[model samples]
Target: MPVFRRRKGNLPRLVPELDDATLGQVRRRLETSWSRGSLDTSVIALVARAIEDAGQDWDRKAHRLEVLAGAAGRAVPDMWRRNSPNDQGAVLLHAWSDLLQAQRGAEVDLAATRDACHLAADLLPADPIPWTLALATLRLERRPHREMSAVWREIKARDLWNREAHLQALAYLSPDECGSTALMLDLLDGIRSVMPPDAPTAGLEIITLVRNYHRAFGADGRAGIGAGEHWRRPDIARALDQAVQDWLRPGFLTHATAVADLNVLAYALVKAARADEALEVLRATNGVATPWPWNTEGDPLERFSHWYGRVGSA
Candidate 1:
């Protein structure tokens, strides 16, 4: 199950430090044009931003995502009626494809979602969003592994470095969910092999390790990791060292989800008793506390602050 859940009264909020001004502007713009016809490039970009933000709070992000997608959906029929479905319509359809999967909340209408994704892909042959959505839908629907591999090929053919696509692929191959640790590691190695040494997507290796670590240790009886677990794996150590270098490279910090990936890395380093290494990752975060790894501890912001404080005092 997801780490975040309704406790007593109020729903969980995202770690405040993760607020991004640029994405906030995109959201505000979409909100302002809620009733307008025809979508813009910024609308599609906002959808991407929303997908990135959902890494923290899926339900809250879905609510905001539907608001923007619903507006775009309302405009699409008229746009298609006037000039045939355009790029904007393609993006709106892609957004709906995601919104549909999100709305179902684990009980997705797989066929409907797939059809929507295909329509969007046909409308905009070169866009990666549709393929990414297809990948996500397939994973959610628990479709055949072969089918997901086919969709992943489509995504990689369009944009090899698409971070969202990679995340979905990882989810499909997660040990606890569908695939095994060996398969997950192979996927990471395959992507890292093709990507440039410093590509932002290379950070995915570190993120996957962190995710897998939590999946194993967070189990009901697991409580804590033992000495020989993933935290001490030689492969994880090497990946962490390489990922830290790649993460610190200039220009990589611009990705919408870079800070979240950094947060995962920092959490892993701390758990592995490598706080000295984690200090640099924490420093790179610039105080942005993503709601993950920390969410497992409750009040993600305070947990992140506690770690950052320990790193500082060290």
Candidate 2:
């Protein structure tokens, strides 16, 4: 579970201690960190927090969101181009989808979400998040029943972590299924394994899983099981507050993971009806500080820019 410390008004100021050259180096490292298939998870955690802490400054938050998305996009193709599949690439793709999905419902594009899920599946066959995303995308698209069942079956056949499977099951199963509770618990176990060691944001995946479970089952049923579980508490509003803190704590943010973590956390919070917190996180990151507007105005070269703008706006 994430460490939840109340934010005292007395929280220490965030001093920018890095010199320009050092800052540039850090940025470069963050931008390219995914090439190795692993990323500094803490860095991403921090980015999420920074965005959350940014509060109310849409322009700044937007800029930060763009930067985070741009870096992730640049690193994504490298995952597929390599001879071996990279987990970070898949993670980044999912991260992008998480970000896009968090936007106002009207702004979401099923095609883009589908593309992101497909990319993630191609990059990390072992990880179930992408497949789950694909299923969710199908649901969003209102695909026919047969296709949905086929997708669900395919997901079930994979050696996915239990929580992922439970999540998939929750997405597709009827509530009366006798073993659903046990399945969710098993899913929680899987999430525990994936939590980053020594990072506040480690519990995020579990939080997301439980939240989704609740959405599928309602507060009195599956959602109420972990009434007080650190990450699965029924009090979604408080959980969101804690998630923001975990993502922003000084030790958690890193360049490579920032955008992805922020995207996921923001989406989760918004879905839980904590849009105010989500907006605050985005603003704190100075996301809109950059003047380039995702570094694209027009033309093919501006594809990255366009993505950046969309990410920020979302």
Candidate 3:
């Protein structure tokens, strides 16, 4: 069986290590779905996870989803095509959501998008992807806060611990977007309070902190919370410490997004100049790169490799 062999400079392609057989299964599943009309919840779920594993580069990620969605749509039988609520109907909704996300920067029709999402929600009443997509579209379009909140509530009502939904909400609440640092922090606090310490989202607080820190301080290492000791705010430090402790334990955050969470933690620790802590995270990551905090500084894997070298030498 083949595997995703790790290399130091595979920029934008770093992902969790998947053995050849498992990876082949995922590929075959996707291919089969595209060839025929196997637009079930399982197919959509697999595609959703693939999107997450593609890292945070919106254009690249969107393009992959666009292809899958388009191919799946074209396979639908013409006799069964009026968007009635069914498995194929849900997939069609996902296709619309994908196209909307791909065209995020350009002018979009909000009303039509919302209608599509609503129809998706009706089709997949139990699935959280539609709700997550709604939150993402609202974030991209910079829709009203109340509207975002309403959709957020709908998501939480369905699956409170949905990682994708929380991520979408986190991006919407970041200082660079609709929310300020305080608002983002508050959102983290609320999530932390409700989530168990071992839950996958236990690492989100640190991710949000890192995003806000970068937002306040430009890409340059200078400014904002200051470098080294000065960067250690009590609240942020406490949150990071707790996240680190929880993350290091056995069986913690054994989800598909585990590597992404670690990527955020490692990036945050490096920015804070906590070399030892960052090294711990890097060691755990084993060179799997997820964009997030490192995209602003050029190739994420390159930055990760540079920092790993510095920490190792130190």
Report, for every candidate in turn, its global Cα lDDT versus the true structure: 0.64, 0.45, 0.63
For 71-186, candidate 3 gives per-residue lDDT tens digits of 44433322223443454344434545454445645555656656666776786576555666677778777899999988888878877676767877887887778988778778
The best candidate by lDDT is: 1
lDDT of 2 at 96: 49
What lDDT tens digits, residue by residue, belong to model 2 across residues 55-153? 433223333443445455534333322422344333433444354444335456666666666676676465444555566666555566576667666
TM-score of candidate 2 against the unseen true structure: 0.32
> How many residue pairs clash in each candidate at the backbone level?
0, 30, 0
Candidate 2: give its CA RMSD in angstroms.
Answer: 15.0
Model 2 misplacement above 4 A? 1-95, 98-103, 171-314
How close to the true structure is residue 23 of candidate 3, measured as C-alpha lDDT? 37
Answer with 1 or 2, whichever has the higher lDDT.
1
What C-alpha lDDT, on a 0 to 100 scale, does residue 96 get in candidate 3? 54
Candidate 2: 10-residue stretch with minimal lDDT: 10-19
Distance from true location, Cα of 272 in model 2, Å: 22
Model 1, 150-267: lDDT tens per residue? 9988987877777777888888888766898888889888887788764547568777766766666662216554633667788788877877777777676555566778888898
Compute the lDDT of residue 233 as modeled in candidate 3. Answer: 83
lDDT of 1 at 314: 55
